[model samples]
Target: MITSAGPEEGKSTTAANLAVVFAQQEKRVLLVDADLRKPTVHYTFNLANNLGLTTVLTKQRTLKESLRHTGIEDLSVLTSGPIPPNPAELIGSKAMKQFLQEAKEQFDIVIFDTPPTLAVTDAQILANLCEGILLVMYSAKSGIDEVNKAKELLLKANGKLLGAVLNHKKAQKEDYYYYGG
Candidate 1:
């Protein structure tokens, strides 16, 4: 699962990139937009969001029926269907666990793009289900305290922190210089 301390910190981008990378390596990858409140995976992949995670969870559609092919070999996406009034409840539902089990059995890698930890409880609810959580922090934009708080929240939810990724870091001139033999 990929999330951040706050919004606009590149969580979705990281999840999408990771899925693509795994797919390139010949692994079957499924990138799920678990951010029910504000989904962006459909937009990122240029896929229709008419039916997706929500539809599957509600039993309105099967997982296979809701999955959207990304046109990239071994890569599929399950976008957040529609904005629901109770996202947190839906995420913590038993159906969600069943969905995860089914997805894991089908894909080599199941990456979820979740909402920010501080912004909603959706990510925290999902933390317990996912094997690990990757927190994406915006360089120079995210405060140390906010990151720590996000970490604390995930840990409290029994989530295994898989370390963090620093995004949007401006490169300095010295960064371009490399030592070579």
Candidate 2:
């Protein structure tokens, strides 16, 4: 799952780009719009939003029926359907877990774009279900206290704390960005 402490931190963009990169490597990738409250995957991919994760989770549609090809080799997307009144409950339901497991079995990588951790409990709920989380934070916009709080919330939810991606970091003349273990 990809999320941030607050909105406009590029979580959705990161998830979409990651999925694309994984697909470019010849891996089957599924980019899921799990941010039920405010989904953008449909817009990002120019796909129909009538049926998707929420539809599958609510048993209104089959998973296969909800998935839409992104015109990218080895890549597919499952946009969040109509926004529900109780997004957290829908996301944390047992049905959601089953959907994720099925998706994992069908794809080499399943990346989810979730809401901001501090904005709602939706991200925390998803974090526990996902293998790990990539917290995106704009270097110039995010504060240490917010990051710390987000980490603490993840810890409380037993979410795997994957290393964060510091986005929009101002690069210096001699500086370079490197990401690896």
Candidate 3:
């Protein structure tokens, strides 16, 4: 699953929460911080990003070396290591392609926290790599115009859009669930 929307729309937070939800369901999930230009998945989880996706792509570190076990048993993360000068090029490069191939084999379900589709080609490119895309929208922040624009771009790229997620939703009593990890 590739989670994205416009900038600062809480993609990282949504991704983290999704991981938590998946964990609650007793599923092994790996979250890949693919937004190399401005990655926040690590920061949201309070993890270091000194060596992650960039390192793996530059060959300075292999995927295994960069993958961090989030300590949330059943969940792991791969941050965007060392911001690259050419983030778009790197994300669309052969290196990232190979990495996703290996990731698919390593994890039960891989979640890519991607850059906004409108801002860069990163999300569109990543949409191709992941099994499905989950576009996140902030209630007051993301306007219908922006959401529609993003939807058009993803659709043009043939992204497997699972659906749009409305974040910051007020949860009623029915929203709560309990399960051991």
| TM agreement with the true structure for every prediction | 0.97, 0.95, 0.88
* Superior candidate under lDDT, 1 versus 2: 1
Residue 120, candidate 3: alpha-carbon lDDT: 86
Instruction: Please list the residue runs of candidate 3 whose C-alpha ends up more than 4 Å from where it truly belongs after superposition.
Output: 170-181
| Candidate 2 lDDT | 0.93
Candidate no. 2 TM-score: 0.95
Error of 2 at 142 (Å): 0.4
lDDT of 3 by residue, 1-181 (tens): 5555588887888788888789768787888788887788888788999988899898899988998887788888888888889988887889988988888788777887888888988888777666788899887788899898888888787788889888877766655654321
Q: Which candidate is the best by TM-score?
A: 1
Q: Which pairs of residues have clashing backbones in candidate 1?
A: none
lDDT of each: 0.95, 0.93, 0.82
Report the candidate with higher TM-score, 1 versus 3. Answer: 1
Displacement of residue 169 (Cα, Å) in model 1 is 0.6
What is the per-residue lDDT of model 1 for residues 1-181, given as tens digits with 9 covering 90 to 100?
Answer: 9999999999999999999999999999999999998899999999999999999999999999999998899999999997788899999999999999999999999999999999999999999999999999999999999999999999999999999999999987777776421
